[model samples]
Target: MASRSRLHVAVFLAPAVLVYTAVMIWPLFNTLRLSLYVEADGVRSFAGLANFATLFGDPRWSEAFWNALGNNFWFFVVHMLVQNPIGVALAAILSHPRLRFAALYRSAIFIPTILSFVIVGFAWKLILSPIWGIAPGILDAVGLKALFAPWLGREEYALTTLALISVWQFVGIPMMLIYAALLSIPEEILEAGEIDGITGWSAFWRIKLPLILPSIGIISILTFVGNFNAFDLIYAAQGALAGPDFSTDILGTFLYRTFFGFQLQLGDPHMGSAIATAMFAIILAGVCIYLFAIQTRMRRYQF
Candidate 1:
């Protein structure tokens, strides 16, 4: 009977397993295989970990790798600092019982989340452009025109500014996720808190906040993975060079440049594969840390 039940479960799971193997497992294996071989002068040869060695050992490759990694971290930090807080604030406001037009506000806030990265990037680029942009006009209307400059065109502010723009586009995601989580908390629990002399700010900080921590953890992990995987926005706004002197280059764009030739530098498939593998490893390590280390502790609380 046990063997029959096992067979039944396997039969039920077969289609999903097949699809997973075909779409995800197969491509991952292929990339890993390609990473093991080197191609040059129209010739391919097995290179073991030489590609990875060059990725880390060679200054030319290593410099860009480290720079991109650092930039990616900064991008992630910006989202954590600006985006999540803004999302939480908005979610708190929208969750208020007396708030009118809440549905409309939620929909409007979420609109940008559905937009393609290309559209968001170019729209922001045009909005921030100095020559024929509305940003300067708005600042001028506010009597702050002097502060307006081409932020996207400047090296010192480019990456940070772009990160803010991305935050603007995606903040809605966290807001919605957190809002739902907040709503899921029992109203009785909140009322109990109020009866126990906990209400308003105190209720939120001491009660609601702890309850929503698991959602925040999920958002943080998602942000980490999404930020590391991001490519389209930077590509659309700054091109593959991620210029303004490569100020916005992240692992995604760096891998793109390595995989495909740009200007004078020829593409190196092996190097690209190495970069991709490194990114995979980084993402895996982060997820593992979050799951094994942080998640266990976070889940121990009944809330």
Candidate 2:
């Protein structure tokens, strides 16, 4: 009977394993292989690390690559410092026992997340348009009209503005995850804390926060992956150029522009693959750090 059960389990797993191998593992290795080769005069030849050397050493490619990478880092930072903390606060507030309309509030806050990237991008663009935008009018109403400008059209503010827009759209994800974590805490633990005179803010800080560390870690990792892989919103709003002097460009848009020839530049799959490989390396390194540094150090509390 044990042998029969084992056979059944193997059968159940086989199809999933095969699908994962075919769809994910194979394509990943293929891309990695492509990154090591170059096409010259309509012929593909193994170029070793030549492609990577050119990517880093060549002036034209290296500048754009570094620019996009830097922008991506800043993008990730904004989400980490602003979005996550705001989400945590909102989740804490909504999780209160006496809070009214909590579900309605959650759904309302989460509505933007469900909208398509195309929609959000275009909507925001229209709203922020300097010539005919409502932003100026709204600012005028609040007597802050002097602060209004074409934020998306300027090099200095474009990236930061887009990052904030992205944060506004996705804040709900962290909020929901943290909210669920907060709700999962055992009432008995809180009761004990109350008995010990640990109430309200003190109870949350000492008792609740530690238990939710794992969830926060997970949310952080997810945010890292998603922000690094982001493309659609930027493309939809700013075009392939990631304009205002390419200030809004990130790794994803850079990869796209590199992979598929943009404007006068011809497509080079080898270089595109190198960019992708680099991205894979970065994301892998982040996950490893989280797994080894953060996850291992976090003490998992049991109810």
Candidate 3:
């Protein structure tokens, strides 16, 4: 009977494992393999770390690579600073037992997350359009038209503007994660807090917040991964070039342009794979850091 049950479990898991291996594991190894070779005279040859050297040591490639990397970090920073905090606040509010229309509020906030990136990108782009966008008209009505500018068209403002737009679209993710964490707190714990005269904000700070630390950590790591992986929305909004002069270019866009080529540039698969490997290293390091922090916290709790 135990053997049969084990077989059942394996049967259920096999498809997903196979699919993951094919789509994810295979591509990853292939990209790494491709990165090791350089094309010369219409023939590919093993170049080892030469591609990586060029990426870091060569001025032309290194400049764009570093620029995109810096921009990607800024993008992640914006989401961390602006999106996660707002989501946490919203989750706190929505989790209030007395809060009315909580379902409606939750739905409204989260609906944007399910929308296609193309739709959100185009919608925001249209709304922010300088000539015919309603943003100017609405600002004019509110006596703040002076604040309106061609944000996407300007180098200084484009990346930040797009980052904020992304924040607006995805803020609800952290909210929902935190909300579930809040809901999962044992009733007995809350009762004990109340018995100790801990109530309302005090109860939350002394009791709830401590318990939800793990969930918050998870949300932070997820945001890091998601922000690093972000491509579709930026691509839809800014194109492969990630223009106004590549100000909005992140690693994903940079990889796309390098791997697939954009306009005058020809695709260099070896260089593209090198960039992808760098991204994998970055994400892996981030995940490892999060894991280390979690383990340290757990050890402290155990002690």
Candidate 4:
């Protein structure tokens, strides 16, 4: 009977396994294999870890690699610091039973999340453009015209500007996730908290916040993965060069530039694969840490 049950499970799992292997597993294996080979003098050969060495040791490659990594970290940080907090706040507000027009507000916030990357990037580029953009006019109306600068064109401001744009585009994801989590909290638990004099902000802080920790953790990890994988918007706005002077280059763009030819260098699939492997390692490590260390502690707070 046990053998029959196991066979039943295998039969059900086989199709998904085959599809996963074809799409995800096979591509990952090929990338790893490609990462271990190098081309030299019109010949390609197994290079073991030499590609990784070059990625770190050679300044030409290492400098750009480090820069992209740092920029990527900043991008992630911006989302965590600005995006998630606002999402939680918005979710808290919208979850209120008496809040007026909540569905309309939710739909409006969420619409941007579904927009095409190119459209968002292109529209923002036009909005921020100095010559014809409305930003300066709006600032002028608000008596802060001097505050308006070429945000996307400046090295110091470009990444942050793009990060904020990204935040605007996707903040609704965490909001919706948190909203669902908030809604899932049993009324009895909330009533008990109320019986203890917990109400308003007190109720949210003592009751709702703790219950939603797991959802927030999931959202955080999702944000980490999504931000690390981000390339489309940056590419759409900045192109492959990621200019002004590669200020906004993240790992995805870096990998793209290395994997495909840019103005400066011919495509090097091996190095590109190495960069991809590194990105995988970083994301894997981060997820593992969250699952093992942080999540274990968070579970103690789970009711």
Candidate 5:
């Protein structure tokens, strides 16, 4: 019976394991392998770390790489500072005991998350366009017309504007996660807090916040991974070039341009793989830091 049960378990797990290996593990290792090689005049050769050195040493590659890296950092920072806090605040409000139409509000807020990146990007682009957008008219109605600009066109505001649009689309994810975390808190603990004169903001700060640290940490890591891997929205909105002079260029766009070769530039798979490898390293490092430094210190509050 023990041997039969073990066989059954293996049979169940085999398909998933095979699929994961084929789709994820294989591609990842292949990309890493490609990164260690270089091509010259159609002849490929082992280059070891030469490609990486060129990526950082050559001005042509290094300038674009560093610019994309910096933009990616800022993209993540905006999501952390703006998206998570707003999500938390929305979750807190929606979780209120006597709030009316709470279900409707929750559903409405989460609507954007289900929409495609292409739709969100184009929709916002049209709405923000200076030539024929509704945003300027709306701002004019509110007596704030001067605040409006061609946000997606100008280099100064393009990256930040795109980041904000991304934030709007994905805020519901953190809201839902944090909402579930808030709901998991014991009613007895909250009641006891009330008895100790800890209600409203004080109750949230003193009693509830500590328990939800794990959820927040998870959300942060997810945001880090997603932001770093982001491509579709930027591509949809700004094209592969990521212009107005590549102001919104990020690692994903950089990889796309390198891999496929945009107008006037020849595609270089080896260099593209190098960029991918770098991105993987960055994401892995962030996850490791979060797991070791942040997650280890968080106490898992039990009911």
Candidate 6:
């Protein structure tokens, strides 16, 4: 009977595992393999690790590589600082037992997340434009017109502004995930805490927050991966150059530019492959650290 049950489980899991391996795992392995080769004149040659060596040692490649990598890190940091906290706060409020119009609030908050990246990017651009944007006009109405500036066009503010915009659109995901985690906690647990004189903020701090640590950790890792892979928004708003002097340039856009060529620079697949490999390595290291270090230590409590 136990053998039969095991077979049943395998039967159900086999198709998903097969599809995942074929679609995701195989392509990743092939890309890693390609990263070890150099392509010239439509011919492929095994370059061992020379591609990686040049990627770090060569001046032309290293500068953009480091800059994009640094920008990506800051992008992830901004999301952690702004998006996660806002999501948690909203989730907490939404989870309140007596809250009205909860469904409507959830739908409205999540609507932006479901929109295509191109739509969100263009919409924000129009709204932030200097000539006819509503943002400056709204600020003027509120007696803060002096605060308005072409933040998207300035080198110093462009990346930060874009990061904030990305956060605004995506916070709904974390909010929903955290809210669901909160709801999964049994009412008996809250009742027990209340019975012992715990209530409000005190109850949440002592009882709820600790239990949601695992969910928060997952959200953090997801934000890290997503931020590092971000390209569409930056491309749509700032173009492939990530301009106003490439201040918003990140690894994804940089890789794209390297692969396809832009203006004076010729496209080089070998270099692009090297950059992609570096990104994959970075993401792999992060995932390993989270899984083996942080995840091993985190215990989700049962209600």
Expressed as tens digits, the lDDT of each residue in 82-153 for candidate 3 is 999899889989999999999999999999999999999999999999877999999999999999999998
What's each prediction's TM-score?
A: 0.97, 0.97, 0.93, 0.97, 0.97, 0.94
lDDT for model 6: 0.92
- Look at candidate 3 and tell me the lDDT of residue 146: 100
Candidate 4 pairs with clashing backbones: none
- Cα lDDT tens digits, model 4, 235-295, are 9999999999999999999999999979978999999999999999999999999999999
Local distance difference test, each candidate: 0.92, 0.94, 0.91, 0.95, 0.95, 0.92
lDDT of 1 by residue, 1-303 (tens): 555656767999999999999999998877777888898779999999999888889998899999999999999999999999899889988998999999999999999999999999999999999998899999999999999989999989999999999999999999999999889888988999899999998888898888888899999999999999999999999999999888899999999999887899998877788888899999999999999999999843453
* Superposition error at 23 for model 6 (Å): 2.3
Task: Please list the residue runs of candidate 2 whose C-alpha ends up more than 4 Å from where it truly belongs after superposition.
Answer: 1-5
Task: Rate residue 195 of model 1 by lDDT.
Answer: 94
Worst 10 residues of 6 by lDDT: 1-10
lDDT of 5 at 283: 100
What is candidate 2's lDDT per residue for 231-282, written digit by digit as tens? Answer: 9989999999999899999999999998887999999899999999999999
Query: What local lDDT does model 2 show for residue 43?
Result: 100
List ranges where model 5 is wrong by over 4 Å: 1-5
Return the clash pairs for model 3, or none: none
